[model samples]
Target: MNSTGKESRHVNIHIASPVEEVYSYASDPANLPEWALGLGGSIENVDGQWVAESSSMGRVVVTFSPENDLGVLDHDVTLPSGETVHNPVRVIADGAGSDVVFTLRRRPGMSDSDFRRDADMVAADLARLKALTEPGQGPR
Candidate 1:
C-alpha cells in the first residue's frame, strides 16, 4: 500500500518466500548494497558501524536495527554531512509468502519530484529483494 501523509510514504512488495527467509536476508546490513542501489554499491564495517560510499552523499555510516527474531528491518543512514534519515522496514507473513514494506520519509525542503524519485528507487529496491529471495527465480 502507498500513502501520502503528514511526514512519510511507503512502498512495498510481495515475495514468494517464508517470512523467516525474507527477514534473514533483508535484515543484514551487509546485504544492503545487493538490493538498495540508491544507498550505495558496497558496504563495510568500520569501528563496529557499517559504512558505505555513496556517490551522492559521499562516505556515510549506517545503523541497523538490532538482531531479533521479529521481522523488523528498520535502519538509519547518517550522511557525510551528519544528517540522519530513518528508514522503517518490515517483513511480514502473508499467508504462505512474505511482504516487505519500506517506509520513505520526506525530508524537510524536499521537492515533490525528488520524493517521487525516492519512492521509485525504493520500489526498484523491493523488486530486487523479491527477485533475490524468491525461489525458482533469478534476479532481473
Candidate 2:
C-alpha cells in the first residue's frame, strides 16, 4: 500500500513448471524485459543500478529485491518524475508446478480506466511469464 492506503489488486497465473525454474527466471531483474512488457521494452545495468528504457516513461532506474532463496520478486520502479511505485511479486510452489502472483497498485488519482489498464497489463505479463517458463516453450 502507498501513502493513500489503497489495497492493491492481485493478479496471478499458474505455470506448468517447477517452482525453482519459475523463481530462477522471474527473480532475475535482467529477465524482466522479456516478460514484463508493461514496465519497459528492455532493461540494462548502468553504473551498478538496473535501468530500463521505458517507452511510457523514458529511461528510469529499477531496483529489485535482493537475490534470496525465497521466491520474493518485489521491485521498486523509479520514474523520471521522481515518483516510485512498489510492485510486489512472488512465485510459489503449487503441487508439481508454480503459482506466480503480482500485486498491481493503483496510483493516487488514477482513473478507473487507467486502473483497469494496469491490471490488464499485469495479466499479460504473467501470461508471458507462464509461456516463457513452461516446458518446451521458452528459449532453451
What lDDT would candidate 2 get against the real structure? 0.88
Model 1: lDDT to the true structure: 0.87
Q: How close is every model to the real structure, measured as TM-score? A: 0.92, 0.93
Q: lDDT by residue for model 2 over 1-140, one digit each (tens)?
A: 24463857999999989899999998887788899999899998888999999887788889989887778999999999999999999898999999998988888877777788889989999999988999987773
lDDT of each: 0.87, 0.88
Q: What lDDT is reached at residue 105 by model 2?
A: 87
Per-residue CA lDDT of model 1 for 3-118, tens digit only, reads 34346887999998999989998888878899888888899998899999888778988899998877999989999879998899999899999999899998877778888988
- TM-score (C-alpha, index-matched) for candidate 1: 0.92
Candidate 1: residue 60 lDDT (0-100): 85
Q: Largest lDDT belongs to which candidate? A: 2
